[model samples]
Target: MRILTIIAATLGLWIAATGVSHAEATYAPQKVVYHINGTGGENGAGYKPALNNISNHISAVGADNLDLRVVMHGDGLGLLQAAIDDQQLQGIIAGLKNDGVQFLVCKNTLTGRNIDPETDLFDVWPEDIVPSGVAELGKLQAEGFAYIKP
Candidate 1:
């Protein structure tokens, strides 16, 4: 029927117009938490990829629009270890922090590994260290922070 055809056409046009309007609008604030549990060593195999993922994440959601946090636990503490002597990594981590990306280390991991946070982790404060990394992540998720494992 002509009426049915006209109705479909009108609906389609309305949807198209609404889509265009939405495309022109800015996005709301996005929050994300990245969990790192893998250890990447001198070969820079796994760690490099995790770093790239973090970089891509920041790029995807304009850094300014994101409340990004990297939760390091288990073997992932190697990232902090890798940065210990590397000034370049320390600088990059500091820059990321300055841009609002937080780096959280697990206190349990430190105690289990017999590692001292004061010397091993650069720029990490006592308050930033959580009692349980995974539990903290779950808490963050409950608080509406998106979860990511990279």
Candidate 2:
């Protein structure tokens, strides 16, 4: 029993010294894409929870080990629009961006909706625009990014 206790303590020490939480070590690096096609109704209600899930996912998997992207098209563009006026949402987005999350906007949505990417959306760049959101989703999936719609 004493020998077992000592071995357990030594294992714990090694884990602590490695600077990796058990959860982080347990999860392999992941390529994930989140789909956003709706505005989640007024005030971007569903957006916050979805963003929160991404935050939680980063926490669990460790940002360095994750390739995460958010593809927003259709009414989903409202996420950026809503963020334009909502500070909390903006902060969440900025935090996610700082953690290396890529936000992809759809050009088709922009042209169809008559929304100006530079002037209307929040913190979106030219490189961030994809020709079609759905196509991007498919491409990402083909590239082995797991699909998630939340």
Candidate 3:
């Protein structure tokens, strides 16, 4: 009877130790997608806030630990326009991209707005443009990406 009790106690301790080790070693990575579609004028008031929000997000999450993507459609394409050309915005976008944040433009909006992506966007690629902005957001959310509209 004493030997059985000792064996049971040893098994309980091993189980408890394994559980603690697993808890310490396991962590879920965060995945986020930000949506921006507001148009900004020459004064740039509308656009500045969105840029700031993106910067804040990157700061909040250690960039290396996050999977981030930004989807732009409608007037939001203006955020990526070549005409705005603010040095701060450029720096932020470049830095974010370096941190693995993808900036995607909506092809439909570009066509409706009559803006040429090749000329209007600073560094957007054809593959980066989605067929529909809102739909893409929905899809990304379903795929386990937390969505933020800013």
On lDDT, the candidate that comes out on top is 2
TM-score of 1: 0.76
Against the true structure, candidate 1 has what lDDT? Answer: 0.80
TM-score of 2: 0.92
TM-score: which candidate is best?
A: 2
Give the TM-score of each candidate: 0.76, 0.92, 0.74
lDDT for 90 in candidate 2 is 92
Q: Which residue runs of candidate 1 sit more than 4 Å off their true CA positions? A: 1-26, 43-45
Which pairs in model 1 have colliding backbones?
none
Can you write out model 1's per-residue Cα lDDT over 51-94, one digit (the tens) per residue? 77877766666677789999999988888788878777777677
Alpha-carbon local distance difference test for all models: 0.80, 0.94, 0.77
Residues 88-132, model 3: lDDT tens digits: 767767887887889888878888889788777777878888988
- Prediction-by-prediction clash tally: 0, 0, 1
lDDT of 1 at 90: 71
Off by over 4 Å in 3: 1-28, 82-84
